[model samples]
Structure formats: C-alpha cells, structure tokens
Target: AQTIHQWPVAEIKAVGSPLSLGCTIKGKSSPNLYWYWQATGGTLQQLFYSITVGQVESVVQLNLSASRPKDDQFILSTEKLLLSHSGFYLCAWSPGQYQDTQYFGPGTRLLVL
Candidate 1:
C-alpha cells in the first residue's frame, strides 16, 4: 500500500521568517508529486510538481519553492514566508503513468503572524 506523510501538522510563523515543510510517499515507484496551498477560506492552488527525481516544475510560484531530492520525498521551503503565505499546505501523489487522479494526505496548515 502507498501512503503519504507530512510534517508539522500546524505551524505559527512570523512574517518574513524562514519556513520549511516536508512530505514523503512510501510504497510507490516514481510517483508524480505535487504541492498545493490553500489560503484562508480560499480554494486550493497548485504550487509545484515533479514528474521525476531532480525535475520539478512550478505550477504557481506564490513566494515559495519546492524540491524533489529523492524518489519518495519532496520538500517545500522559503527564506521568507509572507502573511499571504499563511494557509494550508498539502502534499499529494499519483501514479506517474496515470495523471488523472491524485491522492492527498493530511496537510500542514500554517498561520503567519
């Protein structure tokens, strides 16, 4: 079975401070990884995605960046997180060959002060 795990289920950060979040997928091979964010009461937006190791693409770069350093791990981080960056962050994955359906795990919700 495949599963996804995200760290620091909730975070409170000051505006303009560094931030780091993590996601890992297990039991799947070469799965497509994605990062999504949802602002307060706002719809989810794709932040980044990767089709293979070391190859990441930005779907919507809203003052954040992502990296896929391993086959099963993805990282989201920033040197500075804006107040606008406060929201729910989700890590998701799907079979690389099947791009239609993606599954998301528990997300990390951040509140900017």
Candidate 2:
C-alpha cells in the first residue's frame, strides 16, 4: 500500500514572497507525478508531469518549479508568489504509466494576498 503526504494543509501569503510545497510517498518507490492546480472558482489544470527524479515536464507555464530529489519526495516551489498562484494544489502519483490510475495526496491550499 502507498501513502502520499503533503505539507502545510493551507497557507496565506503575500504576493512576491517565496512559496514551497512538498509531497512525499511512502511504501512506493520511484513513482511518477502528475501535479495539478485549480484556481478559485475555476477549472483544474495540469501543471507538471514527472517520470523520475530530475525528469519533470511542464504542462503549463505557471512560473513554478518542481523537483523530485528522492524516489519518494517531490517539491514544488517558486521564487515569487503571484496572485494567480493562489489556488488548490494537488499532487498525484502513478507507476510511470499514462494509463495507470493515479493516486492523489491530501492537497494544499494557498491564498496569495
């Protein structure tokens, strides 16, 4: 069984400040990530698709960066937080297959003021 963990269930931050969000997987190694976000009262968007450590693909240019430093860890961060960055951030994992059913972590919410 795999367990996904996300840090800081929610946040309230100022614009232009730096932000970092993290996710970790337990009982599973080398899982791929499909990160996503949803704006307030808006639709969901896929942000990053990562196959392995140091192998991340961007689905949108949201001025965010993600890294998988370890097989079980994924990090998303930005040097500056924009108002547009305020949203619901979700981290999901799969067994490195497009058709695999991805398991989602408990997500983080950000409110950029």
- Best model per TM-score: 1
The TM-scores, one per candidate, come to 0.95, 0.93
Give the TM-score comparing model 2 with the true structure, all chains together. 0.93
Q: State the lDDT of candidate 1 residue by residue for 45-73, as single tens digits.
A: 99999999999999886888899999999
lDDT of each: 0.93, 0.89
User: lDDT per residue, candidate 2, 1-113, as tens digits?
Assistant: 88999988999999999999999999877788878998877877989988888888989999999888888888999999999999999999988755588889999999999
Model 1 lDDT-worst window of ten: 96-105
How far does residue 88 in candidate 1 sit from its true spot (Å)?
A: 0.3
